[model samples]
Target: MTGLSPVFPEAVLWDMDGTLLDTEPIWDEAMDALAARHGVPMTPQLRRATLGNNSVDALTKVYDAARLPESGRDFDADEAWMVAMVVKLFARELPWRPGAVALLDLVAAAEIPMVLVTNTMREVADIAIETIGAHRFVATVCGDEVAVGKPAPDIYLRAAEIVGAAPGDCLAIEDSPTGAAAAHAAGVPNLVVPSQIPVAAASKRVFRQTLAGLTVDDLARLFAQARTDTPA
Candidate 1:
């Protein structure tokens, strides 16, 4: 078993996408299908731009890039379609990142108040929680549930509020630059686990660590060590 120093936070906030679930690949496939159906190229840059954004934000980015005629279309409809496609794809391939379940169980057993903070819609978030059996979270905050999404701090701040913890007292676990930035802006210390995107240097400097497959016991030990290591 790997050793952890036992550094614990009053509460923890989790990022949903690549961090907990290996849904990025499914997203890519669905995006490709959507682009093909719409006769628009799903370029690499376009995909990267939408990586950590909400469904509506991503669809807006795509719509702007493809220059599709408005057709008096409701943006929400396009977003719903994309989310529906993703839901169908994920139902067939319920992917979870390595160590996600173990880590979640460990934290839950420790009775650490946990909340899910994601750029996904509330509907998509619910599906993910059910798929991963992560419904134990005290609450879940989605981009669509907030006034703004990642890199805006609104979601993280709201999560902190719901958890009854100061942002500084909560630990935010993220895998994307946008999500990490959001946590940092909310005054929450973040731990990053790189996924579809690399953690930027600035984020690296601020994050507690780039996790390397930590278990619940490992986290408890880490928190203990952190307490000891922290200056009195």
Candidate 2:
């Protein structure tokens, strides 16, 4: 890894699912299996709409598509089922986004604090953190840990607080519109790295940069360049 200039932000906040781990497809496959078991057909459109949302939101989307009556039954049971399915799927394979670990380590080595800000529940986030061996990362703040999930500034703000950085001084790396919006609402500069799902045009306008395939070395170089351009 190339040495990056120390011009990086005081802290960096990360989005978990598509941003760090390639768990989106795993979620899709598990959801599909769940739908199949229930004799409901899962469609790509339905899956896409639920991208980046919490499990409850995703399950509600699936339930709506199947026209399942909103029975006052404990929906938490369904969430638990979904979580178990995801855990089983992950046991078979845990994919990480390219250069994710490298980039995170680069930032860490630069002495910049980092926190995971995810809409995933704390239990799920803990699993992911353990799978990724995320001890090197500073902290993780899950949606369940906050009052609200993404599209609201609460989670991001909580993450910033954990990292002890003001929103303006922190950079948020996100892969979805809802996540990007949350970062924007939190007043943090965002960088979008689009995944299998598309980002909205309105959301795209707020980001400081859009990366095609950023590597750890690339981020290091960016900071290095920034530092070089700064006057002594």
Candidate 3:
């Protein structure tokens, strides 16, 4: 841990899947299994294309790739199957992405408020939180809880409001381009820790190899720097 700085982000928002938990692989596997059960194949290309979408959106992409039905009973059945598969995996082990626990612990210790801002629905997110420890967050902003999901900024905006922070004052920890885009669009400073996907840096984004070994000093330092660089 590094020395605490006088400056602190009003709140820190986190993306739950690949950012905090290594569940993207489980998502990939479940999507593949769903395809296999329906006599369709989930190729690597297809999986990569829909890496960060919610269950329903992912189903749309997968079904399209399979040339299968995308709505009504077909979509619902496939979505249910995928969720069940991943939920079982999550129950067995909600694997933490590298350095996630340490960062969470340190930030919490510093008395910085934290919240889960994720595109994953509340039900599925709740399942993972059991192992992750629900007390880590003051609140969780799920995809279903917002009007729109990531890449749109509704969830992050809502999370900031819930935490009593201004969107511009909050720092978002993200793991993918989709999430980075969402955070940036919301006018929040985001620290991207690449997980299953490598997040590319853009005007409103910053990237780190991993959250491993990062200290509150690191966060404060980065937040301080971004606050200066951020546009009004």
Per-model C-alpha lDDT, please? 0.76, 0.73, 0.81
lDDT of 3 by residue, 78-127 (tens): 66676677777777777889999999999999999999988887768899
Top TM-score hit = 3
Root-mean-square deviation of each candidate, in angstroms?
4.6, 5.5, 3.2
Each prediction's TM-score against the native?
0.83, 0.82, 0.89
Q: Which segments of candidate 2 are over 4 A away from where they belong?
A: 1-7, 37-39, 202-232
Per-candidate clashes come to 13, 0, 0
* Higher-TM-score candidate of 1 and 3: 3
User: Model 2 TM-score?
Assistant: 0.82
**What is candidate 1's lDDT per residue for 62-135, written digit by digit as tens?**
77777777773468777778878877876776777787887888889888999999998877777888886666
lDDT of model 3 at residue 23?
A: 87
Q: Write the per-residue lDDT of candidate 2 for residues 114-211, one digit (tens) a residue.
A: 88899988777778888777786678888888887888899889888888888766778888878877887887766667777766544212332344
- After best superposition, candidate 1 residue 96: deviation in angstroms? 1.3
Ten consecutive residues with minimal summed lDDT in candidate 2? 223-232
